[model samples]
Target chain A: MRQFTATYKLFLQHQITKGRLTLISVMAAIAVLLGFIIGSSGGDTREGAVVLIMGYGINFGVPIIALVLASSSFGQLKEDETLVYLWLKPSSRIATVVAAWFAALSAVIPAVAIPLTITSLVASSFDFSLAGPTFLAISLAVVAYSAVFSFVGLVLKKALIWGFVYIFIWELLIGNLAPGTSKLAIKTYPTSILINMTDEDINGDLTGFFVSTPAAIITLVAITCASIALTAWRLQETEVA
Target chain B: MTQQPPPPSSSQQAEAWPPKDSTIVARSLSKSFRGGLVALSELSVAIGPGVTALLGPNGAGKSTFMRLLCGLTKATTGDIWVAGGNPRKDAAVRGRIGLVPQQDGIFERQQVYDFVYLAAVLHNVDDPQSATLRALELVELNPQELTRPLGSFSKGMRQRAKIAQAIVHDPDVIVLDEPLNGLDPKQRRHMIALFHSLGEQGKTILVSSHILEEVERFGSHIVVLSKGRLAAEGDFRSIRSLMDHQPRKVKIACDKPKNVAARLIESSSIASCTLHDEETFEITTADAGAFRKEIAIACQKSDSLLSEVTPLDEDLESVFRYLVGER
Candidate 1:
């Protein structure tokens, strides 16, 4: 527990800063303003808000924030050669991986969740129901995205670029367009969960990405656990600089 | 060539692990990296408590050996025991071994105090805050400098911070790879004193350096590696003597150089003698001390003044050259 606290504190300091915090807040405002614009421009305010949440929040904001935070968790340390200090510690390898994962999750969660939830609320014209489900979906997405990206950060050198590619090509492109390939993209699972839990149809866009709640939960949990384990195993076996 | 560790006595076997005499022991250790690169090969050594210099040129496997001892990388073959148990398999054993690597891998954005404190926390020190302060103090880092980001620190200050982190936990064994690199002369002297003080406390310190003079300042004990092999071990003087086939060159200044050369050539210890000028003679001998004494006696008998006798090939540089074949 002490090891986790120390690593978490240190890793968090690397992530959270005045500029980053302000940028996240701005992203949140952008989401809210976009939803308001889409609503006041033409159609139902609730529908417009739900469309912005699914379009900008889930498809863009959440994954981008997760990628940045998760990749920075281990990638920065590895690049700086400071990973040796953490690797030489008496803490269990699992603890190290999990601490990094949690730190990334903590950073991305706020940066992503508040913006996403506020966008949903403002888009829906202060409807609590839409905001609540968006919050749940954002929470679930952050966990899966943080774990998978953290694993990539540990395993790859240019994790940030690869993370962006995965977000653009796999999550946004294949996840929405290709029918069966959505299973390979982490964004699909959280989108499926949000669709199943919420009433906002948003032009029936969520129907194509729908999966059973149990399957979505099981897949997310599996990806998170497996990625964390693989990261810990790699750290144990590899000779880091 | 491999040298077996001294067999443990009955009392030692019956007592606890580590055998008390040895702090680090590697048996037939070897490491092969990817792409068919073998960094270390079939090397065996036992290191006791004190300052032992690890001397080798680039790609000599010094860094690999240190990493193996610290459990950062596992050996491809054989085994290693650091501070009593296997650091590779046991976290407890790793806690007792501190390593200051050669690379500049510091958390540059972190404050000096936070960086050292994080190390203390990772080592599971009893009181991390106090231990951090003490470690910084030991490294002689000013109290005001503790809060500044490490990126702002000069190279010497960064080196001291690295040393502070390594010694923060007060481990039983400390492996420092080129710890003296990039330090000013005064800082170098201070670090040498610090290493000597740590050794005096019975802590095993294995420091590697490219500077022979600095290594000499540390101690006489050294482990020399060449081409991923243990070329020589023990005091440099003994190793130099072991390589007796190499001729020792000595320059002598005397009043009658031709007379001295003629008389010195008759001695069995003198391999060859050449008269350089009127008052100087260059003599190559298998034994320098005996030849010096013989020259003194010969000059006394002949009424010739012997001014100076300098042994040209007795320092660590010559010994290292002979072992590594750099000469």
Candidate 2:
């Protein structure tokens, strides 16, 4: 337990550096600013919100932010060669792996959530109903993205570049039109949750793409567990010093 | 002083290398990386309690072997045991082995105290704060300096901070890979003293270095490595003798070098001489100490003033080559 907390605290410090905090703040403000511009422009506010939410948030902004933050959890440590300080200890590898996953969350949640909330609300022309779905969707997205990226960070070299490819090519572009690959897409879960909860009038490319809420939740939860397990196993096998 | 045992054969190494009271043992260890780079070959040796130096030239697999000992890397073959447990297989065994790595990658944003304290907590020490204080004190880092971030420290202080973190948990076996780098002479002396004290406490402390003289100061016991293999192990004297008795080139700077070279050519110790200019010359000597005594006498006879005398082949690579060749 102490080891877990120690790893958690250190990883949190890594995430909340002044430079990164400023970068995340800028990204959040820009996302909100884009949402506000479309909402007040008077051309179908709900559709604009969906474009920003599904197009930018789900497909681009959230995953990219989560990728930089999550992958850096172990990536930066290994690059700096400081991983040996933690790796040579007697503590359980899962403790460190689990703690790193949560610490990435500790910053990732707040960094991605508030902007998403303000973006949806203002973009929906002060629709308070948008808050519930926005929060739930972003919450699920960040947790799932953070776990997968953390494992990717551990196993893959140049993981940030590879993660970018996965998000841009596989998740957004291919998952949009191809139903077979879309079944494997992570964004489908959160997007389905938003479509089901936000508004019955919410319709577009998402009309035929929605999975049931329970199924979506179960898949995301399963991915998080599986990613964490793989990370722990790789942690033991890695030759770090 | 421990006497040199006969060089053990590959088959005999298992029985003859590390004796009964070995604290760390590696048998037939080999590690290879991509591109066919073999860092450590089929080398085997055992180290017991005390400050035994891990001596080798750069790229002699000292760091690789140390990483293997600390469980930071897996062995390509064979086995290694620290305190009767394999650190790679047993997480609990890592608590007993503390490592001071050579890489300069400490937490730069963190204060020295916090870094060492983190190591203490991770090792599950009973009281991290107290252990941290004791470790910092042992390394002689000032209390006021503890609050400063590690990035702001000079190289020497950073080295001390690294030493503090390694000792914070008071592990039974400590592996230091090139720990003396960046330290000034005074800090080096203090560090040697601290290692001596740790050795007296019956801890197995292995300090690795490429420089022969640096290893000599830590203690007479040394495991000399060359090209990923054990070249020699035992007392420092045997190795020192081999280094001293080699035919080495000595350069002398003096007024009237030609006359002095003429006088020195009479002696049997001077195997050959090359007069470079009006005031300088070089000699290849079969007997270094005898040549030193003869040069002064020859200079006086020729009425020449001697300015300097320096050895040319004193680099560690050559010494390692000599050892490897001799063995």
Candidate 3:
């Protein structure tokens, strides 16, 4: 709890003054504003729907935020040579890592989720029934994606590059082209949930792009748990090199 | 040849008084990184109370030894105990020890009070507010700086804040790895005084430093390391006596160097003398104080003024080189 409070204080400071954090928040706001403008244009509903979809896609910013936050989590300690102090402290490593992850996650989730939700509501005419489930799916997606990226952030020195590759190359390219690989992408499960909730027909003929409801929930839970477990294990095993 | 007194017994030596009843013991500790880069090699030492200075040059395993003692990294093959428990297995042991690492281990964006208070809370201190205030006072930080972000602090202020955080929990033993690194002369003096007070308060402190004079000021017990080995251990006087045969170099600047040199050569106390220039001479003496007094008397009798008399071999580097054999 002490570690959590300390890390949260650090996050609050970063959210207020850090340029990159401000940039991410601004980009999220701009993306949401663009979505609302296009959704309210009232010419072609399909185009408006496309804009809303883009807004949802911009939810990728959550993972990016996680990457940025986690990249510095332990890396900053090493760079500043402050790990020695913490390593000598009586606090548990698991507690510290978890606290840092949650702190970073808190900074990011709201930036992406709130903006996206507000835009979707204003643009789509207050369809709470549709928006509610979409929000749920998006939140789950944020948590799952952040967890996985946070683990990657701990493991790799070049976490931002790896995070980009994971989003663009692995999720976009391979998950789209190879039907079998889609299940591995976090977007696959949440998109499935969103599709089920909104009755949206995405990738019409792309069988295996989506899975059953139970499988989606199970996959999300499994991946989240596994990423957290990996992070804890890595914290214990790897020396602060 | 002259015979010297035997070194003091272990019981006659100053005993360290730990703030609490706990002994930090290490036996046959060794550490080697990948590619066979050895950091500590079969080194062993015990620390109980008071300020024990771990003196060593760079890469002499001071940091590595601290890490091993704190259980930050596992010893390749050895055993360590702190507070009657294995540091690796016991979190309670850590609660009794405070570590101030070489680098300022602080989140600079946070305020000073918040940082120190958070550390106290993390260490399970019952009253964080009083603990934080006490710690700030201990470091002599201005109360106004408690509300300011650490990033804006000067180097000495940051170091004091770091020390404040390290001791907020009031641990029995405090390990400071190069606690005086970048401080100015005033700050250094202040910190040295602070260390002495902490020791007087009965907190066992293990401070590491490469600077001999700084360590010499407050180091009640000294453990010297050279190339990852325990080169010397015990009080400074005992260690100095170990190198009794090492000649002391004295420089004399006088008006008549040749006359002084000629006069000094006749005395058995002078081992050798060299003319540095027309007005200066360097002499090797077995007893530095006695030789300096003799030179002063000789100058007075010859009616010559002695401009300067200095001991060149009094510094630690000279003693270290004599003990370790120059690399």
Candidate 4:
């Protein structure tokens, strides 16, 4: 338990010192501003709804932030050669990975979720009841994306490039162009959650392609579990060098 | 020092420590990379209490052996046990052993105290704050410096901090890979003293260094590796004795080089002597002291001036060359 606390503290220290918190804050502020401008702009209520909908679409920021944050956690271990220190500890590999993941997730949650909730309320001028589900969906999406990207970061040396390709080429491109590939992309499932949260009557066309909320929720849970398991396996098997 | 019985044969030594009782034991360990690069082959060693220096030159398989022992990489074929258990399966083994890696690994943005405290936590040390403080004090790091960022530290301070982290948990064994690589002479002296104290406390410390002199300072037992094989292993004097018969070089600048050479040759102490210019001769002697005395007597008899007499092959560089052959 002490080891876990120490590892977590180190993770937090690394995140704070690396300017991750500051970066997250800046991104969230930009996201909030973008949400407000798009929400208030003159358009049909349905079009204005898509604009207001962009706040919940903060799931888009989830993979980007997670990819950047998660990819370097273990790579930094390798670069510093501090993996030996961690490896020599009495804690299990799974525990170390989980501790790091939880620490990073905790730091990023406030960074991503707080701005999202604030922006959603400010931009739409929406009631708490209307924003609640969207907030929950975005929060879940952040955790799911963090887990998946953290796994990628732990396993690959070129995780940043690979993460970029995953988000841009696979999630954005193939996810839109093909239905099968969309199921494989974490973004597609979270986007479905946002589609459910938006006023379906006002924006039927935009939400048409998304799966049901229950199915999206199931996918998110499954992917989160799978990502954590894969990450644990990688953490155990991978050599420090 | 009273000599213990000759160390058990490699195989017997491997099995002597109860698999469940030894701090570390490796038997017939071998590892090879792709492209047929054998990093270690049939390497066997057991490490217990006190400091053991893994002495070797560059590319002598020290790093590979360390990685194998720590279970950072799987040996191609062998068995390794740490604290009476397989390290690969037991995370607890890591807690029992502390490693100070060769690289400077502190996070640039982290305060020194936080960095070491984290290591204590990782090792599951109770009361991490005090443990961290104690570790810092052990390394003799100033208390004020603890709050400062590690990036602001000088190279020597960073090295000390690295040592602090490794011992923070107070593990039974600490492995330091080139722990004194870049320190100035004073820092090196401090580290040597620190290692000696650690050893006196009965902590098993394995320090790897290419510099023989540095290893000689702290290592009670030494293991030498050359080109991925165990070149020699034991006390320094025992290893030194392996090259006992190697020709020792003597440089003499005397008034009568021919007379000195002749006396040395007559005594059968010198294998060969080559006169250089008028006053100097380089003699290869089997027994340097005997040849020196013989030359002294001959010079006195001839009333010849003996300007300089020096043993050219008495230092470590010559000893290493004689033992391992010049690269």
Q: What DockQ values do the models have?
A: 0.71, 0.62, 0.33, 0.59
Compared with the true structure, all predictions reach lDDT values of 0.84, 0.86, 0.72, 0.73
Error of 3 at B226 (Å): 1.9
Clashing pairs in 3: none
* Ranked candidates (TM-score, high to low): 1, 4, 2, 3
lDDT of 1 by residue, B196-282 (tens): 999999999999999999999899899998888888888998888777788998898988888888888899999998888889988
Q: Which candidate tops DockQ?
A: 1
Clashes of each: 0, 0, 0, 4
Q: Which of 1 and 4 is the better model by DockQ?
A: 1
lDDT of 2 by residue, B174-226 (tens): 99988889999999989999998998899999999866667767888888888
For model 1, the local distance difference test gives 0.84
Cα lDDT tens digits, model 3, A170-234, are: 87777777668887677788777766666656557865678876787788888877887788777
The best candidate in terms of lDDT: 2
Expressed as tens digits, the lDDT of each residue in A1-241 for candidate 2 is 7778878988987767777888798888888998889889997787678668877788877898899899988988898899998899888988899999999988888888778888988887977887888889988999999999999998888999999999988898788776667877899999888878866556555566778889889999999999999999999999897
Over 4 Å off in model 4, which ranges? Answer: A17-22, A43-59, A199-208, B1-23, B249-261, B273-283, B286-317
TM-score per prediction, in order, is 0.91, 0.84, 0.83, 0.85
Q: Compare candidates 1 and 3 on TM-score and give the better one.
A: 1
Instruction: List the candidate 1 regions with Cα displacement exceeding 4 Å.
Output: A17-26, A177-179, A202-208, B1-20, B253-255, B266-269, B272-280, B287-297, B305-308
Give the lDDT of residue A104 in candidate 1: 87
lDDT of 4: 0.73
Per-residue lDDT over B19-61 for candidate 4, one digit per residue giving the tens place of the 0 to 100 score: 3324667777888999999988887776777788886678878
